[model samples]
Target: MDKFNRKSIVLLVGLALLLALPPITIAMEEAYFISLFSRIMIYALAAVSLDLILGYAGMASLGHGAFLGVGAYAVGILAFHVTEETAIPFLPGGWAGSINAVISWGSAIVVSSLFALVIGALSLRTSGVYFIMITLAFAQMLFFFFVSLTTYGGEDGINLDQRSQIPGLDLADDASFYYVCLALLLAFVYICYRIVNSRFGMVMRGCKQNETRMRALGYSTYRYKLICFVIAGAGAGLAGALIANQSEFVGPGLMHWTRSGEVMIMVILGGMGTIFGPIFGAVALLLMEEVLAAYTEHWMIILGPVLIFVVLFARRGIYGFLTGDGGRDG
Candidate 1:
């Protein structure tokens, strides 16, 4: 079979396996794995968003976690208001709800995109390490801002009484929620695939390859990069919203620099610029974390070497290795 057919088969099999997990979990009485995989799907979404900018656009933002936190906080804050029986002061009609997934997730994406616009406009002026630092600084600032909000549990974080409602779905059930996450993950991956192959994606990739040439060719690379940044932020915000529902908690920790680093690592480890690579990286890293943590607390010590080996030998990441497409730009 050709490479395309092989990849299609692999993806189809992976999807089938995920789809079968709920029934298998019921049989094995292993409900916890369902939740675990749900978390993986959420982070995989985040990693894919990061790949859009970091891998395709050549924008090494270190503050992507800020968008995730923004989305989580959107849900957390709205839920808090609902629980308190108070209307949102800033919202014109005093909108208040406990489990409106659409509103909360929508707010997350909008807020994160606005934040991205502001940050990108400024940070894009600088390149290289300066850009990275600026993004990190902005994320840290937002992290502390949430930390100072004593009304929302501050550093301790806030918990939702329950997951957000999705019409007739029972999000409280692990199996049901796992399917929700899995479906959203598949949708996000498909969207990213489309974006990475379209005309806009070509322009973004061109900017990554040779910005000066693209600029000389009359392409406004800065604007394209900023739009890409906003798109990535919005994607991360969606992941954040899903994660907040899954965990039923939100905190400043979501925006911590380390979280951003983890997502970046996922992108790099999964083969930069490859649409499906980050998903592979997320699963590998998180699964390793879960399995190794059970055996030893110092799992990072072991994982550190594994990451190094991938970086040095499998430079294209696990997805690249599996597909025999190593060292080629996806």
Candidate 2:
């Protein structure tokens, strides 16, 4: 088959699988499948964002989960204080209005972006282990700060009275919500594809391969890093927003260091730097967790070794074993 035909078939098949998922998981309600897919897509978006920096730009961060937490908390808090009118969230300080859910969703994106910018600016100054720790410190600070906000939920979390309502659709329905999450996943992936191929993306990758070399060529690596960091934060924040809406709840647990580690693991497991890798990672890990937990209570006992083996044996990740990166044009 021609490459175009092959790709189209693949895409069609993927859509078929997703559409079939709700009915296939009859034991679990369609709502459960929808909820699971929402979680998967959100985390996949966050993973893709981290991949931009860690995989493409050669910057490692340990505090990525904080952005997700910030986005979610923003939704939780606003829904609490603002109108119950199912409005889109706004950008911070009422910048944008009525995105999807109208004002509320816009607010979510803005808050996440701003939070990422400030955090990335400070953290980018450091490199290697120092950068990792600094990011972690900042993430932990946010985590604890929210935990201390007794009004919101403190150590616990707050629930959404209602999910973010799509403009004309009832997002409360399982099928509709699943499609929304899937569409966003594809949209975010397309954005990454565009960004990675653009002139700016070329500079970002060049900076990743060699900061000094890129700088010598007259590129400001710091600016590239800052931009990439903001993008990553926005992605994570999007995930947070989805999670809040999916569970109808938001809490500090989503921002913890361990949560950050989970995303990192997803990236690595799916094959760092590959476009499809992070999403694969999220699916494989989550599915594995589901299967193992069903078989036994001590699932972690099996999980730890499986992860170790993958790290040691499948170093290039699942994708590397299936499709050679050098074989494909990026």
Candidate 3:
């Protein structure tokens, strides 16, 4: 088999092996670990989306967390009334409850994409640090707006009454949720692989490396960047929705700039330039958080210096440190 096919086979084998593991359920006491992993995967998905625009498409957006917030709230608010309605109100008549969750997710993507469009349009007019600042400004706008809302958690957050039920499935269980997140994670990785290997993704990557050169080559790199930003925003929104469903909760903290910074750290720590790097980064960070927090309440005290050390020494993060070639391997 060719190198790529061989790699694919290996990955399939790994997945099959995981599935064959005796179905292990987290005990009630240890269930939080599974939930934490679910949260980490959701955040990792958002970071991967950011990598597509920032690492691959030459865009800097500080408001990416806002899109995640958009998604989480979409699920939380709809699940709000879903139990009340025999049918979902989020959709026009026929699509309430389980179907409403899907529709709300769709709306979240659409809404976040529209917001990204406006943000990218305005930010693309600037370059470098200015672009970053503008994105941050938009994020702050949303953050403050969410904080000011008197209803729906406002500054504080609330939990869902119960998990949103799927039409023909019972995914509310912790193990089931973990499996669902795993499926989405694998699907997203495959989608990202396809995107990076495609012509459109090539143009986006070219813009990131040298926008002027791309423009001189007769492509409007701004348009490409904007398109990528919208897609990334939509993807982040989807991640948010999944997270909300996972927790049966939503909060404004999901949109805070600190949250944005955390995602960047995860992306960089895992390997920002590589497609699968962010997943490793996310898992590592979450694992650290879970493990360290067990020993002490001040987990960030340990994490802070470790992240800096990695940034200084590893440079390209764990993936780069492990695979020095640093180019796409799989």
**lDDT, candidate 2, at 157:** 77
Q: Once superposed on the true structure, which residue ranges of model 3 sit more than 4 Å away at CA?
A: 1-22, 25-29, 83-99, 328-330
Ranking by lDDT: 1, 2, 3
* lDDT against the true structure, each candidate: 0.89, 0.79, 0.75
In candidate 1, what are the lDDT values of residues 212-313, reduced to their tens digit? 999999998999999999999998998999989999999999999999999988988888898788988998999999999999999999989988998899
User: Candidate 2 on 303-324: residue-level lDDT in tens?
Assistant: 6887787778776566555444
Superposed Cα deviation of residue 153, candidate 3 (Å):
2.8
- Model 2 misplaced regions, further than 4 Å: 1-12, 26-31, 82-100, 324-330
lDDT (10s digit) by residue, model 3, range 149-260: 7556788765787665566666677667777777777777778778877998899888878778888999988888888888888889888888888877788888889888
> What TM-score does each of the candidates earn?
0.97, 0.88, 0.86
Which candidate tops TM-score?
A: 1
Pairs of colliding residues, candidate 1: none
